[model samples]
Target: MSGTELTVTLSGGSAADARAVVQALEPTFGAADERPGDDGATVHTATFEHEAADRPSDGASADAARLSAPVTVTVQGTPEAVEKASATLSRTFTTRDQGAASGDQEQERELLLEP
Candidate 1:
């Protein structure tokens, strides 16, 4: 399927906090492939299908949305996908521009999400 791949790297948080963010994203991005990072960090990588950004018709419940700890999310894909994902993430977390560096095939934006 045509879609974007997003890698969310969470550091300086407990495993529970990392998992909470991953769980919040799963309904939208599907199951993520999680791995450990240095110094008790967690990294979650997932691909979002093109339609994944569409808001649910029934609306999302408040309990389904949450985030915590310091995390850095890197979204890489077409400009459209990157923008969509960034917007979605911004709503849930306090984000600052880490950077946006582009290459020939794709573009990437780094956002730091604060607790």
Candidate 2:
């Protein structure tokens, strides 16, 4: 874990869709902490630790992975981190801003993703 910690939460999609959403953010956030298996649950969450705005990737394609259906993603972290994650995800998916809540230490933004 690094200084800027971001938590990504997914809902309203299949397990594969959830994984794709998580993987899409990796190019900017780096590999997330031990990705927990989804127990066929409705909500899945992953935490990522980032050092800077964008992480260094190995030329991996983050755009090929596609979602089977619509997904709602909630990114929680510092304002900078949430903004970066949202922007990165929007580039990979058709995203619409749902809403966001912010505090002194952390902020959370929710976006709807369509396949």
Candidate 3:
């Protein structure tokens, strides 16, 4: 099994909402080290449990979501499967964040496999 860690920084949304989105994509991405949240679903940490930060501007409406966290997904399979999983995770998160913009943007870590 090969392990890859990706720290994803999601901004411009509510912490609760963003966490829900990430949790939703977990099954499609890979197994998580640990996950929290039920029904409303907010808060998830996979494997290493990357740090998360919620930054909300006073002027920003309460509906907005701000998320910054590292998600480390580990998959067991050929290199192709691992790569596919990475791409799938990135695309899924990006797709969901598209409709959730209040001038909010999602940031992805440039370096992969780094501690």
Candidate 4:
């Protein structure tokens, strides 16, 4: 992770759906340090670094990826990072902010995403 790091956990959808959501974030957040795996896990996880102000897809459209089903994404990191990730994801998918919780230095936000 080069800058602010955040780990994104996704579930309630096929593995492919999970990967699509993560890839959708690549333009703004940069490619993830840890990419979503092809393993047949019910829950998929990936880590990304926010290369602040280095967004390659400045006006990137959400045409890069699409979901086959609803997926729940949980982003864990500093409050700022979590918020940023949620915002970026929302631009691509129809999402509902399920909820959020914060610890001393870290926060977790869950978003229910629909195609």
Best by TM-score: 2
Q: lDDT, candidate 4, residue 79?
A: 79
Reference-based lDDT, residue 86, model 1:
69
TM-score of each: 0.63, 0.86, 0.32, 0.84
* lDDT preference between candidates 1 and 4, better one: 4
Taking the tens digit of each residue's C-alpha lDDT, what string does model 1 give over 1-115?
Answer: 4554655555545565556555555555555665332345355554544345553322222453455467776777766666656666666556788899787877788887777
RMSD of 1: 4.1
Tens-place lDDT per residue, model 2, 29-77, is 8788856376878888999987735464333355635888899999999
lDDT of 1 at 97: 83
**Candidate 4 lDDT tens digits, 39-61:** 87888888886764456444334
Output the lDDT of residue 9, model 2: 90
- Cα deviation in Å at residue 111, candidate 4? 0.3
**Residue 77 in candidate 1, Cα distance off native in Å:** 2.1
Give the candidate order by descending lDDT. 2, 4, 1, 3
Candidate 4 deviation (Cα RMSD):
2.5
**Structure candidate 3, residue pairs in collision:** 13-64, 13-65, 13-66, 14-64, 14-65, 33-47
Pairwise lDDT winner, candidates 2 and 4 = 2
Name the better of 1 and 2 by lDDT.
Answer: 2
